[model samples]
Target: MLGLRFIGQGFAGLFGLIGLFPVMAQAADSRLQRMETSDAGRGWEAVGRLDVDGEGFCTGALIAPDLVLTAAHCLYDARSGVRIQPKTIEFLAGWRNGRASAYRTVTRAVVHPDYIFDGEVSTDRVRRDIALLQLQRPIRNTTVIPFQTDNRPRKGADVGVVSYAHDRSEAPSIQELCSVMARQEGVLIMSCDVDFGSSGAPVFSFSGGKPRIVSVVSAKAEVDGKRVSLGADLAKELQILRAQLTSTRIGSRMPEGVGRVQVGGARSSGGAKFVRPGG
Candidate 1:
């Protein structure tokens, strides 16, 4: 979700922070019914909510049974500005309202090496702003959303975004059905408005019979007149994610835990790492 507010031509809001998009509760036009049974082949049972400490949280979709995809910037240690230790995090599946249907522990995190949190127009951070979390066990939810892998919608295609943004927000709600503006660099920019808690929510275009995720919410674009947004390509990132997810051991489930460690800044900085993209 991108905002229309102007911080600066170079200021692209938070690299992984929630993009400020206007939130709206539109009618559910989706023809895709919530599946009562899990589709194992499509990796549908992996979507979950990521919670850290108590305040910092974000939405995550499952790309595999044991792997969850989200914005790399989401794992930052805002206080220390460094990467949070994966062992301290937890993944809750089918998270809605205030409760998660199923939960698991995150053993490790694999973020895009090219992910640069600095806010700059020229930097490729916005396009590759993705991260993968390996869950300790496979979540057994039956109502998993399938990833869109075929017939990707073109620019201006009607699409919807869903997320449980804010504590009050419910299941990934549909904001606005805007069209795909353009693929700036490699990022797919949309016209839909979003907010902070909606980070990592899936952007889907209704095609065939189900809503396929064309892109996952990365960062929202700002505008002076035109409203545009950008999303990391799930197709490309999933390639790297598949290799990592398979190599890692699914092993035993991790016990529930909630604590915070430093992330994203210099190891000794002891605060959120602020890296400005060089113009």
Candidate 2:
């Protein structure tokens, strides 16, 4: 798999995690509000961390189960700065070190052959920012967001992008939101603030009375600004992902370490980890 490095260096300050808040606490348009807050309006659960080598490592929702989508750029050779084969790495869902009940290793990755990271096509950055991972087994406990496969949102639609960015701050909690500014040249550009840790966040739309994922956060505008964009119209890539997910058999339960465990919350079945609002 090949792709661009999302946001590159210096993205930390620019993205600020504060930018992750939705433009409006709630959309004013009754129709849009209803769609965005509906049951179907959930976003993807993406886990990304800065690895020991200082590169972004990520894995996230590709479908209901059996697949984890991410940036292929994360799988490069630490020494040579070259693309690494998809087989050399692993994907852990609900990942937490030392927690046996919070992780799962991946079995395969499908990378787009045309992915490039040299910044040559800065104008059209959406082409290769996506990839898919097939888990060795299926995950069944987490909620999965539905994707919109056909038409994307028109320019200026109020959209939301969510990820477990850097560490949680006072802003952008579990389901942070943002608004879409434009969908140009294959990318869905938005003003939702995202930072280094949010590389693979899902970009979603409130359409036809329901929320649906239309794109995945790929990278940001030149770090000179706070907003970012996602790769939309990867229906071909999504088709590949959906096929893998549907073919795999659903497992009886979430593998140990393969689902979210709220960080500061009581260890109940599947509660969220709470962080003091100002902590």
Candidate 3:
């Protein structure tokens, strides 16, 4: 997170550490439904609470039997920019009312190489705010199926999200109909309801009657007086992160891609977009 407040120029709220921002452009009928029981959490078993060092937490989703996807900042010390040890992190899959469908320890982790923990809150920062965690052991539970992902949808496309928040830490919740307000520089700004601990939650698109992740919640910010969640393009960014992790295992340099610099794209002057210094 850039900080706990928006500052009218840069986004500052990172979920699980900052106060919830005022509801700005949330879908009127999309109420959070807590999955406190097995039945309620049936299809969402892969959405888990990421317990970081057992002190703080964030939301993560299993993209593979042994691979978890989440926000890069969640693995870094917000104050020191030091990366947190992978051993201390735990994935409580489908945690609800003190139980989890499966529990696993993180053995290795990888963040987008361009992700700067101490960077200012800008499009560049949010565009690369993604990470991948390899579990010590693969979770083969049938019920805890890893989610499938799709490309970023066009603006105004309907989306969904599942997450654990500071208030609803015991059980995950789902908001089924948030709207993507805009897309720019590989970032998607949504009118979804996200808060502290909601970082790294998966944004789902149910276009073909199947829930496919289209974005990963990076941070929540207010845009044009309306609260919106920020995330990178899932399909593209995930590939970059996967390549980074592959290089890590082989002790080789990462391949060049969109994770680094941004090509020319449209910039918005409205408060709804990511603003640079005095932008």
Candidate 4:
């Protein structure tokens, strides 16, 4: 297990534990575009913000009509170091300007069996840092279609991300093109820009005509002095989480509280911190 590094200020700050830093200079083709209106983000209705108990939020995507995918750490309480109640979480699909295309409450959540809220950064943690949330009701809306996931992308492959950052929390931003810098262990280091409230955002690959989720944003890190975003290989982790959710009932055994706290910044209302790349 590789040790994690802590840096930055609180969630509201410019950069925090989860790595929400100033946008680094990138090619003109890779800038983030704010999805201010519904028409501006038509096909991305499945991606939305996961508001946890009205405290703070993280990015999440609907993988199934009733299943949402996000980072496991987002399910724990940053201050108390306990699992948050599933009922407290709400999925705001295509959330923009305080309105959402679809709304569903969480009935249960299950994290990867190997994930630990130990307040450390490691390949193991990042690789397995994923979770599945069962919604209170199935979102069978016509416009909000769930996304299918595929295998991880090869290094140097072009990828894209849609997320809600702290500065642009009201609306989601789309980075249509970024490159995967490297693949180590079960983690991917990519040049994709991210910030606070971007955790659990979906990384998409457009190998086919439509987009499929390839990874979930876990943290922002400085790899060899270069700013990069970290994510889990969803190919295997997503399968494991699905099995865990189906094999056992997560009703009574579910822990109560927000997820774990990362190093660097103070705890936010969501109990997680944002990391700044190259801070």
Candidate 5:
């Protein structure tokens, strides 16, 4: 139920009054490429849309054959603050024009221990806003190769993002050129174009020849008169989620008569909207 409204300069001006500074002096290129054809989206098969009980969606990435990385907020019911059953979640890899390169159900999900879904926008919430999903089956297809993950990128480093926003939900879009504006308190502020349904989208760093995930989109905010996206550093959070997943066993069946919950309410400063990735 998360939604976005572009307020343009007025939104930026409000942030300026608060003495916050724009991360990037000039706007970074965040032009999106519609991955409507296989040829156009050849190497992006690992990124996918996570469908939550047929009600909402969030962006996610495959980090291992049977493991997916996303935002922890995606796993909670925004209205009741209850955790959604994992069996109801599904991953549609390389989804494009009603088709998918691979499909798999979620067996279990582990959220960061420090993540709080209290509807507050803080460095703590943003920094710990990560989760890991264990897929029912491994995606070993040639086209759907999982991506590798690395530490957060340095400030001003060039980054990229692939996400499914409200306007462009049918097919995923890749912004090949974005910039990491700042790093603070284990959180990353980037000049990446993101909106509702883009939560949990993977932010990639191309330090090596191949693309590696560096952070996960948590929210969109106006920082010092500039529109920017907030992300969680994955290094420590990923390790915690992985350890939890390995040690715990998730139930196979879901509780009976679990209904879908709607999520939308008040907005915070900077016109910020708290999005629950797949909720």
Candidate 6:
């Protein structure tokens, strides 16, 4: 239940409401297994590391050849409260050890129009904390296939996550099965193990017999002194972000306060603890 505190902090209000009962998954939950080898990392090449302006990184997944999905908060500077420049970000597909299966620079990006990056964590913010990035070119790598997304899983369903965090930034790790502890508003609280730089990591559902992304890690929360991961319910928010991306003209200027995730800088002082971008 540890969080990427360096990226941001978790909120406290919702803990009073979520059920502590362990929501079971179709498969037994397993500890995070690092995909350090090519064989261990196969089929998960689409889950790549989002290198933000070279300052830090977050976990992101490809949903289409040119489209990547992640958290909205990742588009801001955790230290300066500034929106990042899309051109400065790089999508390192299947980053393992020191190499990647594919590399692409980000051309344009968009966050949920309603997503506010004020740097505060809350159930409301987490619910809409989703964004999509457009790669400069489509990834034609045969091994790297984009994942289709589905509605968030029910409370009784099991889920999985693949991510890159500060301690294991060189490669991604996977928790094949975890419980979807509870659902409130649009946030899916789960028993997934995650840490800093894990933001924007995709939460997958395997009930359909194939993995389909159903959520994006927004923040991590603690309840009853035990930690749980929080994620965006992708169904509705992703729809809006897609439309925004479609209407966006290449090289067009986005209004300030919107988003572009860059993981740089951090507050040298205290604030509401939530996961910040670029863990």
Question: Which candidate wins on lDDT?
Answer: 6
Per-residue error for 222 in candidate 4, Å, reads 1.2
Candidate 5 lDDT, tens digit per residue, 1-279?
111222321122121122124455346575878888889889999999888777777899999999999988887776666777888889999998889999999988788877777644557777898989999989989989999999889988999999986667778999998998777778787888887778899999998778999999987776544677878988888988888788876673234434332334322222123354323
Candidate 4 lDDT, 155-221, residue by residue in tens: 7778999999877878899999997776778887788888777888999998877899999998876
Q: What's the TM-score of each model vs. the native?
A: 0.69, 0.59, 0.81, 0.85, 0.85, 0.86
Flag regions of model 6 displaced more than 4 Å: 1-27, 255-274, 277-279
TM-score of 1: 0.69
The C-alpha local distance difference test score for the whole of candidate 3 amounts to 0.74
Deviation (Å) of 63 in candidate 5 = 0.4
Q: Choose 3 or 4, whichever is better by TM-score.
A: 4
TM-score of 4: 0.85
For model 3, residues 1-279, the per-residue Cα lDDT tens digits are 212234322334532232223323444639788888899889999999888655567889999999999888777655444567777789999999888999999878888878887766667788788889999999999999999989999877889899987668889999988888767678887888887678789999999999988888887766545567788988888898888777676313322221211111222211112212111
Q: Predicted candidate 6: what Cα RMSD to the true structure?
A: 4.8
| Higher-lDDT candidate of 1 and 3 | 3
- lDDT at 117, model 6: 79
Per residue, candidate 2 scores C-alpha lDDT tens digits across 1-279 of 112123543222221222322332234322212112223323333332212121234325545456666654444432234444433344443334322122445555555555554434443435456667665666564543224444566666776654544443112223335656544566665666555445555565666665566666666553233434555455665676556545655442112222121133332322222111111
lDDT of 1 at 125: 69
lDDT of each: 0.56, 0.44, 0.74, 0.78, 0.77, 0.79
Q: For candidate 6, what is the TM-score?
A: 0.86
lDDT (tens digit, per residue) of candidate 6 on 62-151: 999999999888777665567777877899999999999999998888988877877455567788888899999999999999999998
In model 4, the runs with Cα more than 4 Å from the true position are 1-7, 10-29, 256-279
Q: Count the backbone clashes (under 3 Å) in each candidate.
A: 21, 10, 4, 18, 0, 15
Relative to the true structure, candidate 3 has a C-alpha RMSD (angstroms) of 9.9
